[model samples]
Target: MKKILFIDRDGTLIQEPDKEIPQVDSLEEMVFLPWVISSLNMFIKKWYKLIIVTNQDWLWTELNPRENYTNINNKMFEIFAWEGVTFSHIFECPHFESDNCKCRKPKVWILWDFLSENDIDYKNSYMVWDRDTDSEFAKNIWVWFYKVIYWDDKHNWWNILEFVAG
Candidate 1:
């Protein structure tokens, strides 16, 4: 079975700057956390295509309104491009919690979609999420789960990947 590692964007791979969820509508606020690059590459080296699945209802709406997540893709890619890092795939849920959408975390829609679109072997895939909601999504989807944490000791992506992947 082919394996894929699905990761969360904020608070996990990227440290939550400003003590809050990133309002990364623009590249000016886009910041890469320590070891994020190395951590991802390690999984890739292990034959796991890197994927990121996240929920950002705050993007399109405030006070529980779903916002357009359309801008996020380019912003994220630009950050990676500036840093020379790349990911294979990404999926997101833009609905607010009040929307109670099935596609959001703990719902498994993103994972299911990824599996169907990529023809991935579900049994061999894993997900890394920082919060329980995201983990729940991976669980509901029947994918293995890992917690993505940040350690100040992580200074670069190589070190981060070597430590996490091991």
Candidate 2:
């Protein structure tokens, strides 16, 4: 079984816009945070299988078109591919919080589904995210959690490397 690093997309990897437009709605808005590529590469070098689990509640409304979301997400993949940091899988819950979706953050269904389908060492796995929901999700699945402070200028990917390394 391989150790995995379950990560969040928005805020954790890319900076999130203001609450009014909280998502990376377009390719132009899809930008990686400082040292994110380097930090992800460090984990890759260490042989951690990366996976992305994100909640896209905005996708439920016409205000945020699904096509735009797909393009922006594809852009993220393209950017990461250039640096050789490919995720093993990416899971997203498109339902809003009110939908009570089983795959949303704070729920273990998505992670459990992945675990059942893969050879994962839960004891060695960790969750890297920027929200309390993600933290709760990690706890639900009994994995170590690291809440990346996306709002702090000092909390770059290098810091994440040191945190996991130490």
Candidate 3:
């Protein structure tokens, strides 16, 4: 059985900018939250496969071009690879909430599709996110879930890993 740790991008591992609609318009705006690097390394050493599931609905508009997202992901992957941490896959939904897309968080189609082709230990796999939609996605996929509250003093990724993976 293979264990996986699905993580949310914005507002979970990366710091969401102070905006009503949080977005990283450029690679320069891509800043990781505290303990992200250390926690990623810890999870990698623990032999957990890492996956990033995110909803970038804002990228559907011209305010944030698609290239920005690509550049951000590329730079992020490069940075993570330099630390010996790589994502098994990065799944994102570019459709807005109104689009009623099936791949978005709370739908679980992306995960379900992956599961249909992969041998995953769903009982041992977990999803770490910062929103209710993400938790719902985990529930829809029958996997464990953990919320990463950015403002909390004790909800860092390291602590979450200890509590959830224990």
- How many residue pairs clash per model? 10, 0, 0
The 10-residue segment with the lowest total lDDT in model 1: 63-72
Tens-place lDDT per residue, model 3, 11-96, is 89788888777888777788887777878888888888999999988675797678878888889888878988888898888888
* List of clashing residue pairs for candidate 2: none
Better TM-score candidate (2, 3): 3
Residue 64 miss distance in model 2 (angstroms): 2.1
| Candidate 3 lDDT for residue 87 | 89
TM-score for all predictions?
0.73, 0.91, 0.93
lDDT of 1 by residue, 10-123 (tens): 776655556355445544555666667655656666787877787776555653233323454566677665665578877777777898887777777656655676666667
On TM-score, the candidate that comes out on top is 3
Please tell me which model should have the higher lDDT, number 1 or number 2.
Answer: 2
Runs in model 3 lying further than 4 Å from the true structure: none
Clashes of 1: 10
lDDT at 127 for candidate 1?
A: 75
TM-score of candidate 1 against the unseen true structure = 0.73
